[model samples]
Target: MSNVVAAAENSYLAAFDQPGRATVEPTPRPGWRQAARDRFAELGFPTKRDEDWRFTNVGPVARTEYELAVAPAAVTLDQLEPWIYPEMARAVFVDGHFVAGLSDLDGLPDGVRVGSLAAALEGGDVTAHDHLGRYAPFDRQAFIALNTALFADGAFVAVPAKTVVERPIQLLFVAGPGERRMAFPRNLIVAGEAAQVTLVESYVGLGTESLTCPVTELAADPAAVVDHYRLQQERTDATHIALQHYHCERAANVSTHSLSFGGGLVRNDVWAVLDGEGVECTLNGLYLTRGRQHVDNHMWVEHVKPNCNSYELYKGILEEQSRAVFNGLIHVHPEAQKTDAKQTNRNLLLSSDAGVHTNPQLVIHADDVRCTHGSTVGQLDADAVFYLRSRGIGEEAAKSLLIYAFARDIVDRIRLESVRTDLEEFLFSRLPKGEIVRQAV
Candidate 1:
């Protein structure tokens, strides 16, 4: 076996070798972890030769040997104040383990439950047992297999039938000051029949050199409406790989938004399945990169029944020597007649050294389906920049204003006002002479 395999396997055994660690935080499921462990041993890691990973390389991740944190890192509430929203329920995870002390769920309405996934399993909650490993199978991806086998804790949320949550629930994962350790965060969200809720999965860490792999699975029952967001705000030196799996039942309406700002090497995988007729699914994303950062997004939407609808739009902004990739597919099954699916990917490059690879595809087995996909890559419009410059704006500020105008198309789609407002401020602070842009808003 390669060093990567040997090092990762040793960490796994070490987790079990420590007395009380296993008993303190048992696997989410008993047999599933072993199954995933076996899979990881067999598949190891994916190379660039793999079709899905043709342009993205994991060699840096594979070659490095990272230690796992033995306990939760000490994190203060003051350190978490920036990410927490007022009057919103939140589940907090520090150093890959859920911390009830840092989380708040006091005002959650009836039929809504939120807590640690490990706690739910230890308590023998039937819902957690029935749905934990049902959607995100680890057979295809080694990182996913690693997460399944080693994730000690994460968030668990359940909203029962016909219930409507007034505010979005936050699943915040923070990495505190510690050794350069690896972290796996696993989350599960289940919405019952006709229930409505919004979920935000935020990953934030600063000045830490580590590898973090997270997996989130969402199950939307028939006629359910769920708005979900996956936000990545890691340090520029961190490595982050994340996966999202969504399953929608008949007449269910689901929307997902992805916002990425940091990380040295990042990969995001999103797979959504419309399992019943009359389902509506929408996916939107925006990513920003500078310096030597690398970001990749892989998206797949499957239409299994007739009369289902899905739309996807992803936009990216790259500067300096940054690189990115967007690979998306819309699949219409044979029985999915009258399916309507649309996909689009757009990118703006701010420097000559920056580049991107975009591929949007449609595979239709049904002749009656309506499926379309397109992708584009370009630089900031010279004339538009000139127009702004002629209006007394500095050269740098003019460029920043135009970039903000281009990115807001995706940010404006967010339904949560708090998140949208915060993101706007973050952008302004990052831009050159951003005060001018903020006033323009």
Candidate 2:
């Protein structure tokens, strides 16, 4: 066994009373982490024995060597001249620890708190802690337990009742240069009754061989609306594993948009639960990979109450010898009658060497539920490409145009226009360097 796995099992067993593993410091948890860690040790990493992970492999993730990252180098705003966003409240974290001086949180409204998890906990913001690990049962998932055991820093936002935050809270997580460096970021967003907010979490890297394991949990109370977007663009040799868990209450509306473009090996796991009546949710994702890179996105949407609606659509583009995987599951419980849920996944392969595996599953224990799922994987339409070429378009230009049109369908579904434009620009710039990105969309 690798040292990291050995340390994970033995270190926690040794310090059962102290709570949590050692990271930047000994920030004790409120008793939940200890129980969860013990369970993780007994269960170990999930294998094909676990139905949920039957098709996915954790052997590589389990044996990888990862260490907690240290304090980043002194990179100030003046030195960060290339990073800029439009009129957004921003917070910066380096090596998984909040750097207040490096952050720009100006123009934020009153009654809204945007800070780090460590700082918030030290300041006695205990109300938000109640729902931290409540959504997903960490006892069954090793990664969740590992994150709870080693989490050091991440963005924390809490909106009060009946308040609307006009500006979006932008979070940037930077992984500094170091060998075997690992960072764990935990983000918690809670929107109170009738509250409205938007949150964006962006992950980037300064080094090539780093590991970033992140977990984000969002909670929306009754009649609340929340828009969450996660953008991952890391170094080529880095490995990223991220999980986003969201819970919605009665009449709550939640929209999640994900863009995965970088990293040597990246996997994004999103789970959203609608527990209250009349709750509505929309989950959209886009992934682009080339070379030998590997990208996977797994999503689960559960409806536990009646009269709820949900929609899911994920698009992917793979090139070279890269591989992509998409697994989507929608479940409707017996009490969740009148549930309307639709799910679909589409993939475009630019080269014969590229590979894509997509599957959409539905489990319904309710009779009156309206649920459907479908998946498609194929190359560019030759008819469309020929038509474009006949209309005076060059061969390369025609192929690119057809490919871009396939991806544009999902891009147009993005509610934020600026984010959509930025994503398009980033993809466009990368396409010239890769066979897949060069495609029109």
TM-score of every prediction relative to native: 0.94, 0.90
Q: Could you give candidate 1's per-residue lDDT for residues 1-441 as a string of tens digits?
A: 567456645555455344534232334556777778788877767778789899999877776667666567888889888888866788998877889898888877887889888888789777777888788899988888888877877889999999998878999988767656777888889999999999988888843787889888899999999999888888888899888999999999999999998788999999999999999999999999999999999999999999999999999999999999999999999999999999999999989999999999888899998898999999989999899889898899999998899898888899898889888998898788779889988
**The candidate that achieves the highest TM-score relative to the unseen native structure:** 1
Q: Model 2, stretches more than 4 Å misplaced?
A: 1-29, 48-50, 54-56, 70-73, 78-84, 432-441
Worst 10 residues of 2 by lDDT: 19-28
1-441: candidate 2 lDDT, tens digit per residue: 345456545543443333444333223345666666666776777666676666556666566555565455455675343444556788888777888887778877787888887777666676455666677667757777767766777888888888999888788887776665777787888898999998878888776577787888899999999998888778767788778998999999999888888787787889889999999999988888899888888898999999999999899998898888898999898999999999989999998999887878899999998998999999988898788779887777667666667777767877777778777776666554334444422
The candidate that wins on lDDT is 1
Q: Relative to the true structure, how large is the alpha-carbon lDDT of every model?
A: 0.86, 0.78
